[model samples]
Target: MIFSVNSKVLEKVLSKVYPAVPTRTPMPILENFLFQIEEGKLTITATDMEITLRSAIFIDSTDNAEMVVPAKLLYDIVRSLGDTLIQFQIDIDNNKMQLSTDNGTYNIGYAASSDFPSIPNVNHDKKFSLSAKQLKKALDQTAFAVSKEAIRPAMMGLLFEFNIDGLRFVATDGHRLVRYSLLSEKSEIPEQYVVPERATSVLSKLL
Candidate 1:
């Protein structure tokens, strides 16, 4: 695999999804990010089996390939570099990568591409798109009140409620509670979803 991309833009995207990557996982492969290159676009993904985030960036490449590179090391290297083009050269046979730029060169050890976890395919038949501004507002307002009790799965997450009137985002920690409501154009389908606390946190940063 070979590609050239902007370090600053790549770092921004990785930082957004890195929080969802668990520091300690039962499977060593889970500690890496799956990088898939196709045509001139590069797709990067990070997940902890629950919340998965994928971001894409345009790059210059003639070959397409996929591999799992150490997440923390990749993030650190990009963040430490200046705003210059980063040249990535991958040795698939040995599962190693070399990054070079004006600043310096770095090498990272990676795992077999087949060992990475497959991203779940979500059937969007029941999916609905909500405004990012409104969703971020609601998440910021109510995230603090999510209960820490693991036994109460329902309370461990933020309750997203909607009705004919409007929508409400509510959360509580048994002692304190918070609710953020607002008017919306999408109307009249009464439904609710319990968004896990960890997912909510990532959503807040991503939005």
Candidate 2:
């Protein structure tokens, strides 16, 4: 199967998902991007098994095809190729992905797409929308005090509480406690959850 995409868009999508790709894996294919084309859209997914990332961008393809291409190599190739339309063709028999530009063509090792783990859908019925600035501030004021000791589940995660009044972020160790409260848009917010401290840090940076 063959398809084409905007190199920059592809690069951006890959960059967003690349963080989920593990640097060290027992199966080398785990380090690659699972590329799937269907219904004129191209989806790229990467996962370290704990967290998964999947991004979709429109492409000109009707036929369905899937393959795992070395993530780092694909990232490097597109980065070096500059801004240009990229052509991708997969040779299933040879287990290779051919990337083409006006100037050249390159081949990269491929693995069967069936080997990639399915990314779970994060279907949270309760989703909160908050300003990035407010979220960052809340995290900044609270993240440093988060306890690293795993024994205390409460301290190992950020305590997030919300209601019609506002939102609150709290973290505590036996010695100290830190909390940040923000007055947000008034609404019904019965949802409350403890986000792992590690995930809190990452989401904070992303915001």
Best by lDDT: 1
Give the Cα error of residue 111 in candidate 1, in Å: 1.1
Could you estimate the TM-score for every candidate?
Answer: 0.91, 0.85
Off by over 4 Å in 2: 26-29, 151-154, 186-189
Q: What is the lDDT of candidate 1?
A: 0.86
- Per-residue lDDT of candidate 1, residues 40-156 (tens digit): 888889889989988888888868888898899899889889699899998988888999998788999888778988887887766556889978988998999999899778789
In terms of TM-score, the best-performing candidate is: 1
TM-score of 1: 0.91
Show where candidate 1 strays beyond 4 Å: none
| lDDT, candidate 2, 150-183, per-residue tens | 7877788888888888888888876789988887
Q: Give the CA lDDT, 0 to 100, for residue 156 in model 1.
A: 93
